[model samples]
Target: MPEPDPNVRLSNAEREALIARLQTATEEGRLDLHEFAERSREVYEARTYADVERLLTDLPAEDRALAVPRAPAASGDMVLEPSYTHLKRQGAWIVPGLIRVNPKYSRVTLDFRTAEFTTREVEIAVNLEYAGLKVILPKGAHAIDDGVILEGGQVINRAFTPGGGQRIRLTGRVLYSRLKVRYERRFLWWRW
Candidate 1:
């Protein structure tokens, strides 16, 4: 077979497959959590096949096969809904342009420390009912709370810093729930 084109853009399915492969590697003791997280972030942020292939250079051939080539989508949106259990998305996950979170009687946390943002601006639309939603952003990131229609609930924003870097706009409604947005401070031992 011919070598895959390095400059070819990746599709969502291809990226997800790579992520699953990495997770498998971690489960098989081939990679640790830190290494898997780092590689996973790289996979999501990768634009071309070459960018993704480099991440699997040290992995086994079976794992590398998951990084197949596919067409890229015009736009990407991620949706999350937790019914009873808590859901947390952290590490090196991909952060699309639009994110919709709807949780009922559960908790959802989104950490954007090692996340890859394809666009300069991100929009988060939340429809929470009797649940808790927390968003953690990196320092220097800007966020705007457009507005929220509440029915016996509160929206506490501690990450709204209008400066530079990337921008995140939050909008939606909360009914008998809590939405907290905070920033992650850089520590001495933490390396981004």
Candidate 2:
């Protein structure tokens, strides 16, 4: 089989086309990163919609650089999925760590007793009594618990690592209320 042109960068027009397709699916909560990457890589080799995935699979590793995060430059009502890779711009590089929480349950509370940010520690205290739920979810949390306790913050601290990143606290009532609540989040530790 013929390899694709390595020198060819995706044209702005082509990138726009792909972005449009991805945006449509993302709005519907359908274009996940894995799917987006696969379809995008296929665009170079695709002869037909049905053949797109095959092109994606056949490409060399170098072809994968086409998947760039389209945020900041992306305009209007579109919240792009958070980037998991480290980013560098203007000679500065940023790496993301994890989240830290109390009790270490799948679900958590948000009403912080006192929410503060420090280079060493961060805290979000919540009144467990009125809280229906609370979860310290980062963007694209991937945790799929219907009643996972959390707050709805469009933006979160992406630079922090989840497991040991931040910390939260709740009163005794919060503990009891969370007793029956179940959370189903899978992370790297789960594999080990």
Candidate 3:
């Protein structure tokens, strides 16, 4: 099929389809909530066919209605999938905008105390089964766990409240697992 011209005007139906693709990517842990909102805004503001196509370049096409082909690989997502192992991320690490965690029979720790965040809002998509996941937020950072679905699981938050600071949103399913959100304890000369 011939590639659509970049300057071709976009129809309302095409715009809606692009937005739907963004929503699907968010649900699949490819895009965070903040990213979704931003891209949705772009979709509404988009005028040309290329404008809409740019938003979906990194996402796969699950439906044939779009007709346009996607790039072979999707970027900008960090996935952590482990089974029967222990994974820890701390210190000076770079936190991407989206993190997808799927762990089974494992223990995972994500400490954002000294890490660098590329965006003010981050989303952690967790799909857990028989696992233990601990997230240590930086001081003054807010966290929301409202989007998580628990099936014989727990989502515990020993962290900051919603206020003027960085925000982290957790989503996805937790089956027979435990997800804990807390802050790093600070001492006089060290952190715990």
Two-way lDDT contest, 1 vs 2, winner: 1
Candidate 2 — which residues are off by over 4 angstroms? 1-12, 46-192
lDDT of 3 by residue, 2-64 (tens): 667779876654664566567667767999878987988887788887776766767765532
Q: At residue 175, give the lDDT of candidate 3.
A: 97
lDDT of 2 at 135: 39
Candidates in order: C-alpha RMSD to true structure? 7.6, 14.3, 12.5
Ten residues in sequence with the least summed lDDT for candidate 2: 86-95
Q: Write model 2 residue lDDT over 12-95, tens digit each, in one string.
A: 334444444554554456666577666655664444334432433433443432343332232222112222321111111111
State model 1's lDDT. Answer: 0.80
lDDT accuracy of residue 65 in candidate 2? 27
Worst 10 residues of 3 by lDDT: 64-73
Could you give candidate 1's per-residue lDDT for residues 96-183 as a string of tens digits? 8999999989999999977878889999999999999988888788788876778899888887768687798888899999988888
Give the Cα-based TM-score of candidate 1 against the true structure: 0.63
* Model 3 lDDT, full chain set: 0.79
Error at 146, model 1, angstroms: 2.4
TM-score of each: 0.63, 0.22, 0.60
